[model samples]
Structures are given as structure tokens and as C-alpha cells.
Target: MPYALPLPLAPSWWSRLLARVPVRERRPRLRVVAAPHGGGTAPPTLTELYLARRLDMVRLALFLVDDLPTAEDVVQDAFAAVCRAYGTSLDGLQDPGAYLHTAVVNAARSVLRRRRTARAYVPPHPGAGAPVDEGLLLAEEHRDVLDALAELTRRQREVLVLRYWSELTEEQIARTLGLSRGTVKSTASRALDALERKLAKRTETGR
Candidate 1:
């Protein structure tokens, strides 16, 4: 067995507990390496599957996070998790793509949550004047999109990313986020409506 050696023991409470305990997934390599897809004697393996889908994870992640670098990091992390979960048999997993998609979405959500927690409110002392913006702001549509995205609530952001970037239907988005289909639809509608307003303002002000 891939787990511990099958010890000959009579059926009992202790044995049942040991059997039910899950196997801990090993930490993936720092850099991912997929198994060989085509070889003389060997067959298609999980490693090859991993490499094939790595690019897809990156693309799917970008629409959710809206930052290419961050998205790549997220994909890499997700891949690590997937590889860690890889079993020698690859049984019971009817759809690896579904598994990867769910993992990436969860990882992205975790990243966003950590960012928010890191931003816990800190009051400024009397002498600490508001920090000055050293003129890094650029005038562009991408910037406008960034601003609009930042303004959205977290759920709105996720819904928009799934609907537009991932091209998922409301039912799919809802299933991914663990929300109702109606909620997903409502969130996307609100997010898009707000983004349109922001774009309109930018157009009128020439900013």
C-alpha cells in the first residue's frame, strides 16, 4: 500500500480510526515537474497532466486577480497543492480539470483574504500627515479598470471574474463560490453596473 504497510490486525475501534485517517499530501517541489506524456514503455501520467494545465491555470487565474504577476504566483501555489494531492493511482478523480479549477479559485480567495487581514485598520498619530502620492498614478483604461475593481465588494469581484474572465455561467460561478445562482447573477450585475459608471466618469472628466 502507498500508506503504511498493511499490518495484520483484527478488526477493532483502533483499526477503524487508523483506516479513516487521511494521508497527508507531501509538499510539492519548489519548481513543478510533470510526468512524461509520451515515452516508449511508460504511459500518460499525472505529471504530464499537470504541465499541460499549468498555462490554463495561469489564464483562468488572471481574470480573477487582475494582476498577472500575482496570478502567476497563485497558479504556481495552486499547482503545488494539486501535485501534493496527486496519488499514484489517480483513482476516484473523474475530472482533474474540475479539481484544478476549484483549487485555483480557493487559493485565490485565500490570497485575497490574507491581503485583507494584513490591511487591518491602523490609526495614524497626530503628527503623521497623510502620505503623499509621489506621482505614480498613470492615466489609462487599465488603470480605470483597476480603480473600479478595487471599489467592488469581494463577492462582486469574484462574480465578475468568473462571469467575464472565466466565461462561467451563473450556475457555475455560484457552484464555484458556494453561493446561490441568484446571488451570483445579482453580484455580477452590480459589479458590471458599477464598472460602467466608473468608466463613464473617466470618459467625461478625461481622467
Candidate 2:
């Protein structure tokens, strides 16, 4: 009679372990165990991770990119990149959540870069018509704020958006943008001042 090896733990066991841990402690760290009958060990897949964090990722991307469809595309591309780079198993990734966040941010940046390039290549005609942005859907009160937001430089805008919209701490923003905490603080301060000045100017002009 042939002896059979013990089957590996089910994915639910890993999910339970994850649920018990605090959010900050929930890093990817599953071991691969060889199956009894098969080629090799199958590590945990990204499916659970996707299901758990997809909505939050989409929101984050939306804040960065400012369009729902573009945000969705950015998130989908981020997940696809992660899968391609790490495989469906997400093996060897220490923090897949962080990886996804960074990927989405980078993708959003790329979209902005392309927009800037396209704008430079195509000069606007006098009173040229343009497509309405979805930002118009925001309340009238918010339009002023968004207009002021658009006046800020890209780096300033990113710092403000990540700080306020995403509510990430200075340290978190520093790590995400690969900048020093001091830089993040200074940039945020300057961005806020710039926004206040823009809003003030807008109010004065309206009166």
C-alpha cells in the first residue's frame, strides 16, 4: 500500500489568520507546500487579496486620477501587473497591498504625464470647445475648491490629495512617494498656502 502525505491547509485557514491580525500586520507571508500528487507547491493566490482590497484600491486611484473610468483602469492595470510580476500565487511579495498602492499611484502619474504631453502637442484655438470633465458633477461649493486644486503644481497637488483625500500620515506619504518626511511636510504646507491664496483670489474676483 502506498503512503499518502498530509494535505496542505486550505485558503480559509490563511484568511482566518489574516483576519485575526491588525491591519498594519497583515503582510503577505504564506509558505508553499508541495501537493501529494503533483508538480509543485501552490502558494496562496491573489484572489482573496483582490476581493478584500479592490474597493479601497479603486477609491485611492480615483482620488489620484480624478475620473472613475480612468481610476478603474489604473487599478485593473495595477492588479494585472502584480499578477504578471508575481504570478497568480503572489509568491515572494512581502507586502502586496503596498505594492498595489504604489502601482496605482504610478499608473495615475503616467496618465497625468500623458495628458500634459498631449496638451503641449495640441495648441488650443481661440474659444475652442472642450469635452466636459466629470468633475462638473461635484457640488457648486466643491467646484471652487477643485478649481483651486487645479492651480497647484503636480507635486503640490499629489501631496495635498494624499494628505487630505486619502488621509495618509506624513510618514506614509513619504514612504509611498519615496520622499523624506520633512519634504512631505514642507510640500503640504506650501500646497495649503497656495490653495488658500487661489481661493482668496477667486472670491475677490467674484465680488
Candidate 3:
């Protein structure tokens, strides 16, 4: 059986966790092997998929986890798992893109699970700076937005980012997130309303 990559939250709440965090220095790019999409006869190879989709997948994972290294790790692990499960020939799979999308989402959930577990047991040391320091790295406006974003439920965050930033249609998002179209639509509506309220509150308080 294919490993089920269930979302940590319900489909209606497939949100992300954004924190005020420092951006890491850019890492060297992954070397991509060029391969043409197999014509009517064959499916595109995994190498082709990686070369084409790695950046986009990384961005998706980054949006979810809010950390570049963790996002990259999530993508790397997803690819490695697929390679292990299917070898180089992905021809038989119905939708490799969807499979990879599920993999990245599952991997990101695993990272967050571990992070939450670690935080439960480990207390911060005295005099330690915030795990994420926004003031030094982000402008006031950016910080306010992110701070407001952080207040949202994980599923709400996910819905908004996928809807707006990723520019996925409701049906596409439903498919990617294993949600019903109705659920996606309602969640996005509520999330938008909530985000607007949060931003407005912040603005009013700042003034």
C-alpha cells in the first residue's frame, strides 16, 4: 500500500505555521539532471521531475515550515523516498506530480511534529535570544504581516498560502491537500476574513 500522507490538521484546516524568523544565507543550488518529458510513448523520468519541480516544491515546503533548511530537507527526503519506493522508472504511476506533492506535504508534517515534540521537552536557556528574531531581519511592515500570519491556525495558513501565493485553483488545492472543493472554498473564505481582521487589529494598535 502507498504510505498515507495524512495532513496533521483536517482538510478544512490545512494551514501552515509561520513564525518571525531569520532567513538563512542561500544554499548552493541542487544540481539537476536534464531529461526531456517522454513523448506519448514514455513518462518523464524522476530526474526530469526533479529538475523541473525542485524549486517549486522547496518553496511550497518553505511556506509550510518557514525554514529553508527544513524545507530543503523535506524535499530531499520526499525524492529519496520515491526513488526507494519506485526506483528510476516512474512510468507506471498515474500522477507522479501529485504523488510528489503528497510526499512533500507529509514530510513537512513530520518535521513539524518533531519540532513540537522537541519544544515540549526542552526549555529555553536564560539569556538566549528568541528562537526566531524578526526585528533584526524584517522591516516593520513585513514583521507585522508575519506576526499576524503566525496567529492563524496551521490549516488556515496553508489554505491562504496555497490559494494566494501558490495561485492554485480551489479544485487544484483540494486535490493537492486531499480536501473537498467545498471545504477548500469555505476554509479559504474564513481564513481570508480572519487574516484581514488580524491585520486590521495590528494596524489599529500600531497607530
Worst 10 residues of 3 by lDDT: 10-19
Ranking by TM-score: 3, 2, 1
lDDT (10s digit) by residue, model 3, range 1-207: 211223333222222222323433343343333446743444457887787678777767866776666778999999987788777777565666778877887788899889889889999555442235323433343545556666788777777767754557788778878899999889988987887787778768892
**Where is model 3 more than 4 Å wrong at Cα?**
1-41, 124-143
Each prediction's TM-score against the native? Answer: 0.61, 0.65, 0.68
Count: clashes, candidate 2: 0
Candidate 2 global CA lDDT score: 0.65
CA lDDT of each prediction against the hidden true structure: 0.59, 0.65, 0.67
Which candidate leads the pack in TM-score? 3
Q: TM-score for model 1? A: 0.61
Question: 1-207 in candidate 1: lDDT tens per residue?
Answer: 223322253223223323443332332322323445742233224676566666656656754665656677898887777667766334444556556677888888888777667667644334342123211121232455555666778788777655654456677777778999988877777777787787678768986
Better of 2 and 3 by lDDT: 3
- Work out how many backbone clashes candidate 3 has: 7
Mark the 10 consecutive residues where model 2 has the least summed lDDT.
Answer: 1-10
What are the RMSDs of all candidates, in order? 18.7, 13.7, 9.3
